[model samples]
Target chain A: MANGIIEKVKEQATSVWEKVHGSQVAESILRPGSPFKKGYSDTPRNRSYVIMNNVLYHLHPVKVKRHGVRLSYTLCLGGISFFLFILLTITGIFLMFYYAPTAEAAYSDVAALSTSVAFGSLVRNMHRWGAHFMVLSVFLHMSRVFYHGAYKPPREFNWVVGVILLLLTLLLSFTGYLLPWDQLALWAVTVGTNMAGFVPVFGGQVKFLLLGSVEVTADTILRWYVLHVLFFPFIIVIFMAVHFWRVRKDGGISGPL
Target chain B: MSDIPEHLLRRSAEAKAKALGIPVEDVLAEMTGEAAPTPMDIGEQPKVETVVAPDPATPAAVPVAEPETPSQEPTPPAPVMAASSADAGDVDYDAAATKAGMPASLLKRSVEAKAKASGASPASVLAEMLGEEVPAAPPAASAPPPAEPAPVEEITESVAEVVEIPIVEPAAAASVAAEPPAASRSGGATAVAARPLAQPEAVPEGVRTQRLLTVVKANAIQQVKSEPTDKVNTWPHLMIMEFAALLAVTAVLIVLSVILQAPLLESANFNATPNPSKAPWYFLGLQELLSYFDPQIAGVTVPTIIGLVGFMAIPYVDRNPSTKPSDRKFAIFMYTFFMMGAATLTIFGVLFRGPGFNFTYPWADGIFFDDLKDWVNF
Candidate 1:
């Protein structure tokens, strides 16, 4: 049986080599000692080619106006806001490892995370501050765009997309505010959602939908924890993709008008 | 600016007025003054060429001079020749500008200056260069007197300097040479160009075109003293800038988070509602508003309207084409007022509102920090 297995493996290796060597060009490039460099030539044309070939880099225009990236003009507020979102996502995931969404365990889990888990406090701190900073930066970005009149003309639709994003940011922050299952989180969310309850026809229903009950219960904690860590983040990602894509389509960050 | 047309100025004024339910002339008067400045100019290309180029005889055909001149003294003869050539061929300003390695807005302005220097109506010159019929006579009043023409000696000196330098790359000259007649044909018919006396009859159109192309090329070389719109590539410049900003933001956030722990009070107890339950800082504005009006109005109706009208409807309603803040005085005033009110209300909610959500100064008991400590120390 061992001899037969060895022969079969040798046959497979031979076939693979035959396939590889059948194409002379592939054989030359894929050979163990081949001198081929993976990157394109360093010419300006090839530099553009590199951008076009890459998936991530292609989102950026090969050339951008200097004003679009000016520190004073944009303050890179949008970029910083996005970076904070990424930081929150990472830290939030780390927090989840030590967290329990259930009301019976949620607050205790947080206590345990802070007391037992290494770097737990640091991660949590980063996430909290990142959330607040994201909100602040997004607000400032909107103001920047408005003051610069960057929302005019072709960028009008992008501005609306941006507004939706602003709403998303607030929603994300609000939902996450309740995850700690502490008095501040609980009362703050209750008061904040109560505002939503003031909606004309669907106020009570909306509140019920959000809290998963009439008040902040185990279900409410679980639902908010899920929304904060997963659902809202997922939705925000979708909206963010559309937002970034639309910004590019609307001629990259609006400059002047 | 050669880039912002007078018609646009008028249209923006009209739109603002109509939106505000005021007279168009009033809007015009309000927007026309200090709002027009080159300081922090956005450099949008003139839309006038598209609108006015199509009909040569239209009253809008009056070719205005360049609005902002380069701070650096430009070579007089170069732009004069460039403008004349641009007019002669109905040069596709956008394409030619690209070929000359300058932005279209700046090129348009430069061309206008050139036209003004040559004592020609830019549109008519373009029409003539394209071999189109010129308007019978542009009323003398239409032509503004030349603001300042470089002295003949200075102009010649500059012309000599330009010719000797050969500053423009050969590739750019070749590209410029190729674009003219094709672009000129589409430039719209208006008038024939009065041939420059310096033109040699023996020279072919292509050769003359080459010389004119050189003029534009030279202007671009000279204009390099001015800031360029797209100076650096986005990859390194934008990406690096964004990364640096992220690092800075992270550093600030780290310090803040480390210095002040986020508040996490005792596990939620519905039976023990805090005396003045408050929302997050962002919602403080709405919460403050709730004190003034019914919850339905402050929380629901007003926010919804502001969202729909202030953000969504702004582009459609405001419609003032000028992006400058000075020009957008009324819009700015409204925005400022709304922002200030929201900020004031938020401050009141976050700081001043005390026990039982009653209005109280932050320092009602003592110093502001002592009161703040009472809340935090709890």
Candidate 2:
């Protein structure tokens, strides 16, 4: 059995090597001590060195000389945003254990959370404020970058992507804003969606897409509840990663003019 | 490229040609073949050239006269020639002069004097060489008649001696071989160039505020003069300031959160409806707008559209230099105006709009009918 497993592994490695490098090249490259090596140098001063040299270094550079400390903690607006996401993930998971999506139980589960769960208010407030903080910080962060002229030259395109992400973030906030569905929430959403009706071109289509109907009824609530809980967050996270990648690619908020 | 001489280009081209396996002879032949015709081709076809075999008989007659004439006459002859050309110059040597154009004539006299010494006119003369049209003149003014202005012009000739002797660079000296008249013309005006204009180079009054801290020393000025650090560098200071602000806000929020515990409003009552519904304050702006307009336009559409549009428009509108307050004036204005307007409108709506058409609600009907409809119906 061991021999068979070893043979299988060898066959897979050969196949992988062939795919990455055609047979002749792979055969020559795989030959040991061919002089040239791939990837970062292992000795030091590069990524591998950074990883091997310091024990606490696995987190990547906390503060790059360029992207800054706020960006480092991801606690600046994006960080606060990412933190809220983490808090939401945690609180959301716990909330999920007790809560049912069904209209019958969803409100009851939330009530139970307030009355029964220890630190549930803390979790709930943290999540709530986290969402708020995420929105506020993200906007603040975008404004900071804008004022800094960080959006010029190589970063111009990224700024456009950032603006898109900002819209996504507002969507996340709006969809989440309706989840509790009290009179305040219902009416607030009613007020919110009513505003969506003014979109010069996309107004009706967007309203329909959002509420699933002409009014904020049960269908509207369920749709938003799903989007708030699931869809928008997933989409935002992918975009958030892309936004950070672009920031790094853009050479870290081009300082001043 | 840092002033490397032509040989380096030649050597590099040769090296490149060799490396490329191109024949050097073919390259050299091509380069030279294209070059040889250029001098004869581009140099003007001189109307007066090929004088080399200048009439053999004329040369013999000229030298025969050269031995007889006084050498002093040769020196004076060059001066006479220069005066004729330079008199026709910008100075107007004024075959006459008014007090105003005196700089021009004295200028010509001085140029004439220098030509008597130098033997050739300068190759080039600038506009100002005609002497400054300034009001100073002891020369032609003293000459009784324009014809006898020759004496004043002569004095200028002598005066040209007192200046302009030491410029000895040979290649530059060649430029003046034909430049003696220009020198005489230039001589009168060197003083006029002394235009004591106000100096922008003078230190600014702002320097009074420029004193360096004792700890920073002279280096502070030098440092700032070159590449001063922006506020971002004072990271510790910013941290302290941010924390101080955060602490103050935290204290206030905690006090408020404790003293006026945020009501955990009755959980999700779908049936027993709250009489007056309200959103979180951050959103009251949108909720408030609902009162002023239709639900579709005011509530659902406008806020979403505004939020998206405002977010998108930020980069376009805020084209300031940097994050500094001095930069981005419009950005600051628009942001402040929008936020304030939104906040104010929202607050006014929540505080005064009074339950948003409350009389239309089921419970408000009895109060509505008794007070409002009773008058209308009666």
Candidate 3:
């Protein structure tokens, strides 16, 4: 009786799977060369189509030099940096749900994540570490490109764009460092901004503009929050788009050397 | 025919007359049939003499001369006649057939049928069929006997028809030969005699005689700037490795997150400042520089001028084209030196500096950095 019941359940599950996968909706969603698309066979033509027909084609060409694919050649540092940015964004959004950008709530809200919220501390930890990793990866990626002399000739402008991206990543990481509104966040930002106040003539104005006042306050938290979550992200994304495009246009990742 | 502008027709007639080495009036008169065909000697015309193959076995080789004069209208019978003279032994028939996308047997059969009908060798016919220039004929005197007069008349007729027709479809021309119009039965009969004995079945629409517009040598048109490099598809090759990297990074991040809790200290108390307040780890290197120099030089000038602008200028300033490590020793050395210096400064700021920002060993001072407070206990 149990065996018959199990067989019936198995048959029903198979039918449901077939119904969903074979539906027109599913077919429409899975593009022509998508691996998940029904009846997708591995062929040379299909391999080309897989990139050509997908959005990833925007970032990567249909083919790259064989050496470009090797792990040691690039160390995949650039790709890892991009992936870390995405991971941070995901974890950042989750943290935002429980966070408030006010001095009164920010510290307690962060502390509560470790005690009350489910996976909140874990996600927060990921966001923090991921941001650090992104900074490290972007720096390493720049170093790798320099070591390959990939910045020469047509790639010179792309290297400039890369430097700008690195600056933006640092700014994003620095701004987020203050969101917790703790003693560490407060003093760390104070020391950092004190240096900004040392800028020659317009130092005072720059410091005021950055802190949203003479010093870090509730207003500074809100300002940094918006910059961290929205403004910098928007600017960085545009730069990343141009960077990825120029990589392909400048004839892809530099050399075997 | 009346719809064609007179000057355009006259210009075309002039071009044809020049090609055929005859008067424009003669060509115009021949087109209107207002006079008898010009009795031009075939031997005097270089084009005609060049096409007159000495090998009697390749009688159909005559039409191979038509494609030489760019101004002349394409003769519908040329491909047929050319296919018939496929006896040119130099061409690899199997390779040509494969390139042309047809079975070798089918190509051979077509060549044989055309050859039998026109009394031409199959080798020369195949060569012409493959769009290769037929080897220059010996002379007009040694030209094949059977099709000698036929080529001259065919040339004049094709030249006369040039101004009236913009394009001639081969299938339509074949049909015209099969059922000649009442007015042109003699010309149609000559075409029919030269036609291939067995027409290829179901010839795809794209398979038509290609006309050469110009002959720009490969070097003149294509500038090969770079050598073809070894390449692999991004899908399974690059993408698979990329996926592995992504997964590996994610696993590491998750494991790190599980083990290490990100620090959150007491709420901000502006009145009671923490001693030795330091910036984020990334900025610690700059702060370390602050201890050695004026704040303006270390903080503002160094970060802006030397750090950001200087790094951006590396490629432009270096001017060294070679990427080889051995060749770029100076560039590599400077970068490595800068990296090591910054790393040392950052480490000193993070671990050595204690209360009142004074230098102190982390082991002796019980570690002042709050971010790492949880990881290291006194």
Candidate 4:
């Protein structure tokens, strides 16, 4: 049978891997209980140990309900959204090196980065597209949860947490939108902050807090740059820790009930 | 157009008072004589009678029919049968009712009334309804026994039962095909048995509705599963999916970034505003709203308040315990409508607005990409 051949090939391949990776360094790094090392036997117990022992793998549980993993149900949207966020963070950090967030320098810096710096456009593009993707994937993730009724009961608090995360993602994108400081960035932010000025009692105060002036300026660019680079990302990291922790505590992604 | 039977009203009042943590005497004292004739005020009384009565005509017996009841009478009795079968016998009906979703007060009155009317002991009636045993009905009902004494152990057992229900249901999580047969509760045992297990003929080609019973059973047998019985490990399952997503996203973005460069149209000049200056795509939804309302409501008040209220109200408003989408049609529909409205508004703002902010389709001139028209022309 094809399965028998596959099993034989897998056995051979694993033994070969073990032989190649069986040095003293490998052994030190991958002890019997190490997440990097698989146990002698390919049993469920060992597989579980593989997940539980590793610092990175420990985030997930040893056993998973089959329903929770169904691709049709989840569409892996939340995972994709999280992945996109990570990608954005990495690319955004690189973009920050070349970007100068000031009224005079912002536009020229972006133009130079794209035209002169090697792979600078590529990095910028990845960050830009990743932001857009995270927004979309987060929205789709919310929709998936809604459609699946995964937001019901015990998981209700997590759903609210997810909504807050979604808002944070939007804010992240909106703040970053102005860092380019071109005609598009300037006008788009002008229209956006104008909306904040419509808030009732403390509208003007909030607008001042955001723009640091009656209009978008050097100060506004600097404020948005700090938020996009540091302040918002820090808040997001804290919220994400809670969000994933709650997902685990609230019984792991709410299978069919 | 008659008053609720004085005895039935008294029992319902006592049950409600108990549920509300109020004294029964205070509840009874509060009701005036003429209030009884207004069946509208005593709506809870008829619901209790309906649950208790095995017959569909039970509401008529409660004397609160008000000539508008017969049409809607059949609906409640079916659930009574389901309530008994789903959590019958040694399982406390009151506790099971709460779990199987016959609320405490409603099931308490129903179980008591049904037992009294049948002249059989409550436990025996419950057992009989479960199709386990058929206790003979007593000939006479001249004297009824007082309610059973509740021991400490029994109270604790019921509490445990209530706590355990939620955990058990998700573990016994049936497949889509298995659900319909179980959920069609009114369709008796024979009917359920007659239905094919995984009706291949019913399912469309290329789609298999196979039950994951083997996986569930394997998980059930193991004390220490490699992963949580109810969850998949994130490393391989989730990590792989996310990695694939990242690759696909990066590839697409690469192609896009290579083909079309990001726009950088000169420096910001305060004197020169783009004719149809607009917000980003995400805030385009709000910009669209501004067209219909005053800036305060559309931009600040409505958006802020609606987001807060909508997110917070989900748990409180939707008390439906089931998570199956089929069971939650209205919730799905309303959410879909809200999302679709936002999408429509964003699309309108992003693609339709032109110079002077007037309506213009994507094909029209004076749009964002109008300057690139010569290069883009096919």
User: DockQ of all candidates, in order?
Assistant: 0.38, 0.10, 0.60, 0.36
Best by TM-score: 3
Model 3 lDDT tens row, B125-219 = 56545542222322221212233324545454443211122114643442222221222222231221222222323345565422211112334
Report the TM-score of the second chain of model 4 against its true counterpart: 0.37
Estimated TM-score for each candidate: 0.58, 0.45, 0.69, 0.59
Q: What is candidate 4's lDDT per residue for B198-309, written digit by digit as tens?
A: 3234455564332211111222234543222334555466656656767887788778667655666778887789878888888888998998899988998767887766
Cα deviation at A94, candidate 2, in Å, is: 1.7
Ranking by TM-score: 3, 4, 1, 2
Candidate closest to the true structure, highest lDDT: 3
The alpha-carbon deviation from the true structure for residue B105 of candidate 1, after best TM-score superposition, in angstroms, is 58
- For residues A95-118, write the lDDT of model 4, one tens digit per residue: 888988888888888988888999
lDDT of 2 by residue, A77-104 (tens): 5444555566567766766676665555
Model 3 residue B17 CA deviation in Å: 45
Model 3: CA > 4 A from native: A1-20, B1-224
Give the CA lDDT, 0 to 100, for residue A231 in model 4. 91
lDDT of 2 by residue, B143-225 (tens): 11111112222222222212223223322322322222332333332110010122212435443211100111233234422
Which stretches of model 1 miss by more than 4 angstroms? A1-43, A46-50, B1-231, B366-378
Instruction: Give per-residue CA lDDT, model 1, range B1-378, as digits (tens).
Output: 334557667767677676666677765655564332121101121011111122232324444434342111111111222334543546577755554566878867765774575445664433333322122332222322222322333222223122212214333332232222322344422111111223233444454321211112235345533332443566566767877887888898888767666666788788888767888888888988998899999989878889545677787787887789889989888877887898898888888887677788765633222113334554
Q: Interface RMSD in Å per candidate, to 1 decimal?
A: 2.2, 6.7, 0.6, 2.4
Error of 4 at B234 (Å): 5.4
